[model samples]
Target chain A: MSRNLLLISTSTTHGTGYLEHAEEEIKSLLEGKKSILFIPYARPGGISHSDYTAKAREAFERWGISVSGVHEYDDPVKAVNEAEAVFIGGGNTFVLLRNLYANKLVEPLRHRVLKGMPYMGTSAGTNVAGRTIGTTNDMPIVHVKTFDALQLVPFNINPHFQDPDPNSTHMGETRDTRIAEFHHHNRQPVIGLREGSMLRVKGDGVKLLGPHTARVFLQGQKPMEFKTTEEIHFLMDAY
Target chain B: MSRNLLLISTSTTHGTGYLEHAEEEIKSLLEGKKSILFIPYARPGGISHSDYTAKAREAFERWGISVSGVHEYDDPVKAVNEAEAVFIGGGNTFVLLRNLYANKLVEPLRHRVLKGMPYMGTSAGTNVAGRTIGTTNDMPIVHVKTFDALQLVPFNINPHFQDPDPNSTHMGETRDTRIAEFHHHNRQPVIGLREGSMLRVKGDGVKLLGPHTARVFLQGQKPMEFKTTEEIHFLMDAY
Candidate 1:
């Protein structure tokens, strides 16, 4: 099984231009690909798909690559079948997955990626790359038929994971507490990717990129932290 | 229509005993009722339902009132129908709603509450009282059949609502941003209740209790802040 995936925590970081922190990695992932298909269904800040696609176009054109939104074509499944690469920008995970199922693109997209077409996603996009969207931080603006996601990876992804702040006064559940709660009902391992962190999976191996360490959560065990330069097999292998 | 609902933002506030902060308001709501049927299905922090019910039992017993978990009865619907009052404590909204649907308690609970049974909830309990559980801050640890909730109130509730921090370095979406995104897909108004805040509904009148102002968001209009003493007609009346 040859699979290429770039799962990112966020599209933008604090005080940085969009995708600026992961620019080099993104370009390298798209090397030798003439054009890429963009899925903007997440619609950050409730933006329209076309407007969101324009933002992606502006970013990728800088790297001498042309971008086309999947919504621009009449047959989205056909677009995925012919695309050289696919990129999904982040927003609301529920909204993205609902639209993905609505267009019947989940299976077609998964099949294409299994054959080794490069695929990359950020935030909500990255969340859908996991087994289920059950761990998303986004509000359920709308409900999908099911929580079943792409299953590109066996474990779930908790994008935008932040460590608990000892000095904070907010009483809302912390990210760690939320993921721990997920394990009570679900058995999948969860990779908590902090800002500026990403997971690159090629074939059976996975690499953690960026400067921060990724937090990994499994059922019945304490969470472990993985640095940018470590090999974690449980992350890439199906549990 | 006569509806007695005490929608609480949280059971506990910063640096306080559980339900200690809202004890007076809760006591006022439950006066004359000898007992309360507690739905501990939310199970905060993955605690057992009996343990959560024990917490509620401890709180109400202090006020000369008694509490029993719905799970204690083999027929939850009968327990709800025969109960003098109902209380749902704080926890994950997704888990809470899924269990509510699984046990077939949604419609029965709604009917009993509409018949003038005193009903109260905190956090996730507060969230399910709205038109839908679409505005909760909790993560989706489990998937529910629908975002459709009890619709006890016309508007949705964003409990534990916090304003955007001006000096924070975090890149995650703020509470305000998340609610704005909710309005893009859903047409219902959303009420943002900060900690130590609650809603009191009786007959055709609605009152905001506690100390903080509630933020009201309607489609195609700027979010308006309403004080505890303000008259909010659109709140009690279904949109």
Candidate 2:
């Protein structure tokens, strides 16, 4: 079975409502699904799980889908097993992966998704679906047992990727600089998803979705800019 | 003896030479010292440890101080114990902490500094000198054994902190937003040191150095803006 996933760069774009920009893709991916198992584990900005889940519910409910948070169930593993679909919202990657490990849901969710469960992720949510959380832009607010994440995708995902601002004088490392640093110890390719872009994967097929172009960084070569119109099926073998 | 440290925000400000902005502080901290042991483990931009050390040597040579990298020593702990002064330059914090632990130098370096040996750090270097590396702004490019650090200071440090750009259309979390998330899980106060800033800790006094104001985030309180002239001695009790 092929994994069905819509990994978004962000839940909301500047001056836009939550998931507003990706509504069309979200609707397309969840077609015919009656409900979604929302994973609010990332808890963007440290909001409570329930509060975070409510945000996801509010968005999905408008699209005519019933949404329940994974936290609502005693057995999170079983929830994934019975869910029609899973949607993990964006937040702190460390917190998201830590809770996944804490709940022992990484393997089970990976298994369920491999069997073709529709999976949706935004930002930090998308970061965890990749080979490892090594390229995340989030602060290490919490420590996880390992940086190794779900092998749902062979390459790592870098959400909210912004190119270096030429006129700016800031001294922090640029997104590209950090990704290059990541290549020093890691050999996996990284998909740098700009604010409005995303990756849609179905079985052996993959497409870069949205209006912006994605930056693909390989270990030994210069990073390539992939347009939404380009074919990235070869990325399936990125491992 | 009290810890003596000059933890700087960044080694190079936008148009300045390496350590140019913090030359006075560097000189004051290492006064009369004949030689310095440098920890170039952070290896900025993925440069080799030796090449990184050469960068430090070139900068300090102008100031008339002899420099050597810890990597050159047979044992890092012994090097830290014997050095007249220690300076850790900036790069990737995880790599720095991982190597510090791998070489078993964290505790020895901590002990040496607590004896009043001058300790200096820039960016990732300043980050690890804090209670933990939990508030770092760098990408989690590697798996560290732990987020715990030297505890040279009672609070965590967020170096190279930039305020939200009012004109930025970027949707990524702002520095303040990330620090707030850090406060949720960590109680220690965080000093959001902007570029060109440095923190000086002497026997019983601490001074915030540089022209820019620093943002201090404490759990449950509105983050306060602190100035270079303000007294932050209270931060020692932050733990």
DockQ each: 0.83, 0.88
- lDDT score of residue A229 within candidate 2: 58
Candidate 1, residue A69: lDDT: 99
lDDT of 2 by residue, B1-239 (tens): 48899999999998999999999989999999989999999888999999999999999999999999999988778888889999999999999999999999999999989989999999999999999999988888889979999999889999999988989999889999999998888899999999999999987577899999999988999999888967798888875
TM-score of chain B of 2: 0.98
Q: Which stretches of candidate 2 lie over 4 Å from their true place?
A: none
TM-score of each: 0.99, 0.99
Task: Give the clashing residue pairs of candidate 1, or none.
Answer: none
Instruction: Tell me the TM-score of model 1.
Output: 0.99
Candidate number of the best DockQ = 2
lDDT of 2: 0.92
Model 2 clashing-pair count: 0
Clashes of each: 0, 0
C-alpha lDDT (0 to 100) for residue A143 of candidate 2: 90
